[model samples]
Target: MKLLLLKTLLQRRARDEGFTLPMVIALGFVMILLGMTNIVKSSEENLNAITQNSSSDALAVAEVGITKYRELLNQNRILTIYNDDQWNTNANVTGQACNDLTTTPTGWEDGGTATAPNDTTKWWELREDTDGDGTDELIGEYRLVSYQYDIDDDDFDSSTPPTNNNGQFSPSDDNANTTDDFTFNDVTYDPLGVIGTSNSPEGYNPTGILTVQGRSTDGSEAQIKVEIPLRINQNDLENLDPALWIGSTDTTYLANLNGNLGSLTVTDGNVVIIDAASAGSSGCSDPADGASYTVISDAREVPSISSIASKRTEAVNAGINNSIPVTSPAVLGKTDDDPYVTPPSGATFDEDIHCANISDCRYYYDLSATDITAVTETDGIAKVTLYVDGNLNINQDLGSNVSSSYLEIYVTNSGSITIDSDSTNTINALIHAPESQLTVNGTGTVKINGSVWVDKFVNNATVEIEPDTTRISSLNTAPSYKLYSTATARTPRPLTGSPTNWVREEVQ
Candidate 1:
């Protein structure tokens, strides 16, 4: 009887054992499913992180676009080849312009024209990684490029502006002194709405505003804007007093060493001499004075000849780097072969531009080899830059209708610039021939309006040069004529709108 009870108890124990094994198996299955669920969740998180990283990279690419433009508009790149012209109205870049310019003129005055004024908004792309290390990627490109012009800035927006450049943003006054520095018109823009009108506490320029948009291969993109005021006007250059910033390794004649052979009149500017002594033996006597003139003095405490040349070259390089690439020959002139002489009567700059619009524009001029040197301007228009690799014969009349700040003639690798205008009309331009001399001789009443810089000066006592501050500065517009860059100036735009200002959907 005891053995029978034992067997019955064993049977019960076996049934309980079977149920336990099944429970264990079911729990094991649940554990495996839970592990899989966690893995799936982690994978989703990784995917999201990857997406965010891509977006960030796209944003960086866009920022790079804006930065590229900023480098082009740097002020240091736009100084006249002479003077400490390094002499800037902006105190930050100036060591000296006048007696303590940092203290005088109070602050930066753009003279109504931007102190660092730029012309237009330029565009470009990021394709090759020139850095052999494979850092440069064939990412994306800028789709849109635009420049804004304040209606108040010389009213440049009027009368069919040169097609597709800049336009006025509003008509409200942007008085720099007033507390309400920004006034936005109740204008509606894209779905994004009128954005960041008062974004910058330091008001926007009444001259230039640059805009550029960049995209990446990943289909992500970004846009940026910046202020790029052009420093085109030279009238404010007075602070550099002796607007004539000259330097020489040898004597730069100011007055005939032997006698006051001819006459020169600097209505309201100072004369700065560098090197040996003043160009002429006798300091230029201001006719306005009682048969007396300002004494010739080396404005610089120590001659800054080499330093000036080096800096000027750097500035030129900067301008060239920042410019839009356009192919133009050094020699520009009247006939196809007469690039060294005056144009035929009916020839106009328009004609040259039309011809240059085609392929065979540059016949055989070589700037790298210094192949030619001579500028004999043709009559119809008053402005043109004849970059010769040899000598300059500037004997043309600058038409009466010459525009302010117009014409620039640069004679590179030259020994001298001889002048004998057929007509006495004033010829305006900024002539730079660092290694040459200037010799003026004309029977008719001759007048030259602008600055001449070279190794020396030799006047036949016939031509009188009157400083016309209005001549267009080649240094200021270096990119347009000498560089592969465009004529526009660009910088990172003002940051006006924050997340609070952007559309709710647009902000991350």
Candidate 2:
């Protein structure tokens, strides 16, 4: 009975107990732990990849930006040098070398041994064994160095090759020795280099070379150097041709009057001499109006008798003694009588009419020997007559070709008349003022049928005459009245207390 009870209790205990629950709990814990480990490993791998790519990309972009900035700086320097007026090709300022970074390794230091690391600060000590020797001998060294930023730490690091086995680079050292170790302050950090040698207060590091390295955002490395030459300004080309600069031609003309004509004289019977001497006066005047004349200097004296006599004797001996008859029958009329009363019925003469004023007189009639005749003087008319008995002589001293039919006449008549031409050729005539004096002043042609007389010549006046193929003469003489008259006789005064009249009044 005791044995049976024990067996039953044991059976009950065995049936109530469970071992699968604990086992299932332990298996769940293990799976959770394995999953957590896989998640941590994947996260770390992804973060590492992202960090490396981000660092490389940032570095590339920064390098590209720096390169562009440097290029712009170089271009600006070149322009500044070119615009300087004092720039000269032979001028000695300062010079440095421009190197291609792609071909040369900048900021390089030589390692003491092949297995040992190099000191970047000792760039000058670096030497290439061009002859394949086991050891390199120091020769010439590159002056420029380069560096890149460590994107992971935001620190600047030299991209140039190591200079020596010291595995260091410093910009503070003046010589490339083992004592020189690269430091942040030793490298030339300026990206622009615009400050030039004054980049440091104690002066730029000689042995402590700077390293400038650039990379494009697309992963391209570029290294270049530029040369800037000074040039002269546009205005500084002293020997340049004026035509090329101004793009035009230059010209000039005569300025003012130089001098005056000399003296004149006349001596003969009924002969008129015209003075061709230059007159220094300023304005024109009338010949018939006794009050209108040019002012003459009291210092102006007539020619001496000896001079006149010599000229007259020379002229007479030249077979020029042909004279007009003084006793020829005069026109049967008074000074105011009409001389054209017997004009032919079907004749015509060139005529011009001007305003009725003494200041403006019209000239008419053909300038030919056949049209040479006298007419009457009326209120607005003045007549001119030339009487030829046998022959007339026309002398032109200026030595110019004379037209046989040329004639000049001045008449005050407002109406036309018939001009009787003895020749069939056309007559060339020039007629001017009836009251103003006409002076033959230039070298020209002239013809005459009889004698001519000219009393005086005003300043700046010219006269040309052509007469018939006959004897003509001329005589020059002084005026009979004063040339310049005072205004005292012609000016009138205002009555007392009346406003004074500033205008001058004409005398009756």
Candidate 3:
């Protein structure tokens, strides 16, 4: 009829374009191989997140060159690690870079090394903001490869690194006969494998394995290494000694002649009355019932059996930061803006005890040796142990005053040992308070040159402190318990032990 309806509309448009152009070229070739595997997995996850963020910033720049070379060799490893011969590699072929006086300074060395620091020293740069955003971020730099193992067996041989660098490090070559100095019990330890030594400000060193390197300015050079091993401490509280003050409890008049065990308070006329007091080799006639003071506890009743006890539980566990744990009594508050220098207003008891120059002082207490700034100091201790757990009132007024030089008063107090001085005082030192009760109330006359071991002994007043074996063997050499107990004494980790005390060895 009109050509049979145009052949059925061209056969229904060829079955509706059967498979349009090969299914649009096979779905555009599988979407271009899934967009090239997501662009090669986002370019290998941005090159493995930029090689794990430049290998965690080259190991935090090798732990900031092993903590600034263990704080520039433990703050003065005997004048900069015994004169650091510069660990070879031609010393400093111009490792130049890092001056910073404030031209915009405080951390960002060019990772210097082409060498160039003939003079003008002091350099440290490491910039890092970490997004807190004050503006820092430089990431990657370190130094101190002055490696000096000369061969102690830690390995660094990188094609022979030492080169016989002779600057100084002799303990008589390691003790061929002397020089090394060790001394166990009496406490010495000079050079001998070090970790302890201090005449006060003198120095010492011994654990320094070596190796510091670090890199990664970002080109992906990324490197790192550490190996450290440092530590230090050993002052045995100067020397330690109270020689003799044996006042087991007798109360004033002069503690039974000098030696003590008590049983003498003769009071017919208030007498210790040395009526012609001259008798040696056991002579000196005088009625019995002696003791003015001086009796070192235990006649046999033994409180805790002491020859002279009470190290205050081994100096409160070797944490003795020059202690002052009064517990109450307000712990002796000061505040006048307290920079120290406020104790003498009536002075019953208050000793700041750290007077570098508290108005030109003569040291009434141990000067700073440790306790370093005492984080928050509540009377911090360790200038060699002053542990006074509590009660040690020594009311002062001593106007005669006499301490020619050399003075040490450890006073391991726990309670009671009062001496209300009125004037004319003389306590040369070595007064070990075995565990309390030994009062000597005021009106003053006190003169105890050296030695005192108390427990229960009251000497009404008028002074004491007598046994002086050549000045208590030149003032004890620190032994009889440097902190013995609480599991084998401590307080000399030397330098790198641990918060809980570690490091007899740590290779990595």
Select the stronger candidate by lDDT from 1 and 2: 1
lDDT of 1 by residue, 46-161 (tens): 99898777766666665665555444323222211111222333332232222222221112222233222222222234566656887755656543254343423332334544
Write candidate 3's Cα lDDT for 112-166 as tens digits.
Answer: 5323211113223567887996998776665544434221322332455543423
Candidate 3 has an lDDT of 0.36
Q: In candidate 2, how many Å is residue 413 off?
A: 73
CA lDDT, every model vs. true structure = 0.38, 0.24, 0.36
> Residue 50 of model 3: what lDDT?
84
lDDT of 2 at 184: 24
Per-residue lDDT tens digits for candidate 2, residues 220-243, read 333322222111121211111110
RMSD (CA, angstroms), candidate 2: 41.3
Mark the regions of model 2 whose C-alpha exceeds 4 Å error after superposition: 1-16, 78-202, 205-508
Indicate the worst ten consecutive residues by lDDT in candidate 2: 244-253
TM-score: model 1 vs. ground truth: 0.32
Top candidate by TM-score: 1
Q: What is the TM-score of each candidate against the true structure?
A: 0.32, 0.17, 0.25
